[model samples]
Target: MDDLFDDILNLEEQYYKEGYDEGYKDGAEAGRIEGRSVGMKTGFEKFLEAGRLQGKAIVWQSRLPSQQESSTSAGNSQQETVQTVPSPTSQDGKDSEPRRLPPLSSNPRLEKNITMLYGILEPGTLSTKNDDESVNDFDSRLKGAQSRVKMIERAIGEGAGDKGSANRNRQQAQKNENIEDIGRIPQRTDVVMGTV
Candidate 1:
């Protein structure tokens, strides 16, 4: 009689336990999938920005006159400057002369900043690990690279259109896009609907 009553009395508790276990398993699986998707998207965005910075650094380095060129120029101040346009071969093996940007004015400070920017963004040095330390380091380096880019842009008078505004417009536009992306994330309706 006691055994019969025990089963009858605990029916609600048993169902609760079973439901809890099932919900836990489902929640864990869903969380894993969502976490992975977000992680991949974030990692790709970070690396894309890093690659952009690296490319900028390479171009800036190329534009800055080399020490040899500077020395030669100093010695021959009267001669007209000659720009060597490299005939970069296309992927189809066609001879295509790439449009060359005029060299940046030779400034010691500008050259040092460019070199520093390249060093900070060196490809091999950045870690792709998702650990806390690596992520923090990557963020710091990225911020540093961005600040350096703004400084370089200011020095070279590239991105600043209006006086005293250095890339702020572009940065603000990017921030707005990111905010819109965040707003688009699907909210969990199952909990609200009492389905979980």
Candidate 2:
């Protein structure tokens, strides 16, 4: 009887361990799947939001030149208040000065951001994932988009600071070169002074 009871207890112990192991495996898989789904969803949302912000910044930057031109025009036409507002008969009808858009290459950073934005936000990009699209691919794209957008934002925030400084330095260097040229006598290549 003792031996039989021991056998029954051992069988119960073995079955319990097997059931626990199965349950643990199932739970772990489910958790992993859930985690990946959540991660993908969040990554997509971040990409979308970043794309929108970048698009807006590009649009705003494009409009800056036009706005500045219009303001300058307005200032110049301040004396002629009536004519300042463009007439319907004028060329380009609605406005005497036609609106201008910045070229795609106007700002390299902006262009990069816009390109990245479009690539990520285009139809079927996030809406429908490709069968071959792996989680790592999605994550990589998300990180790329985020970084590019940040770069663009940083550039916009810094304004034309670096560019302006570069321009100033270039002009100064040109001035120095001109001064050096002025101080030096022109060498006559056609005449050999020592021989002559």
Candidate 3:
């Protein structure tokens, strides 16, 4: 009968449609999971770098001489300096000798650069949104902060002359290693396979 033959011929097409629909659904779900994981990893790496820069800025700011000291020194260059000896015991009876960091040399330009660096890296000013504008803003701020770090390092004499060249080489090598780490992420092969 005609009806029986027609049904048999349509059977293969029906199965093909069902298989295609299932494949599409599975692929969509898998893609969503993979995309979310990659996004989270990327966001974590970016924020970690920002936090590291923020910590550096805080340490640098603390090392700078206080404004009061700078102003008084500027007003009286010939005054005799008095040194206060630290007491061995505090009021709580604990050893009070705290390790002190050497103050950065009082240079106005250096101070301004340090301030700018801190301002750029202020956590409140950064946004975590993934929209195009926010992403571009975050990227630009990150680049600015990185350049500020290099400038600060140079200002602090870490990048001075022959010794500085060696330090710079070491830094470059470290940066290359970081790049290689990022590159180690597996690339998607779906497009190539689809084309084939």
Candidate achieving higher TM-score, 1 or 2: 1
Q: How accurate locally, in lDDT, is each candidate?
A: 0.84, 0.64, 0.80
Candidate with top lDDT is 1
Which stretches in model 1 have alpha-carbon errors above 4 Å? Answer: 1-3, 67-98, 160-196
The local lDDT score (0 to 100) that residue 60 gets in candidate 2 is 52
In the order shown, what is each candidate's alpha-carbon RMSD? 12.0, 20.4, 13.0
Q: Where does candidate 1 clash, by residue pair?
A: none
Candidate 3, residue 76: Cα displacement in angstroms equals: 20
User: Could you tell me the lDDT of residue 67 within candidate 1?
Assistant: 49
Q: Model 3, 11-49: lDDT tens per residue?
A: 999999999999999999999999999999998998899
Regions of candidate 2 where Cα sits further than 4 Å from its true position:
1-3, 9-12, 18-22, 25-44, 47-109, 130-133, 158-196
In candidate 1, how many clashes are counted? 0
Lowest summed lDDT across 10 adjacent residues in model 1 is found at: 78-87
* TM-score of every candidate relative to the true structure: 0.66, 0.40, 0.64
Ten consecutive residues with minimal summed lDDT in candidate 2? 97-106
Best by TM-score: 1
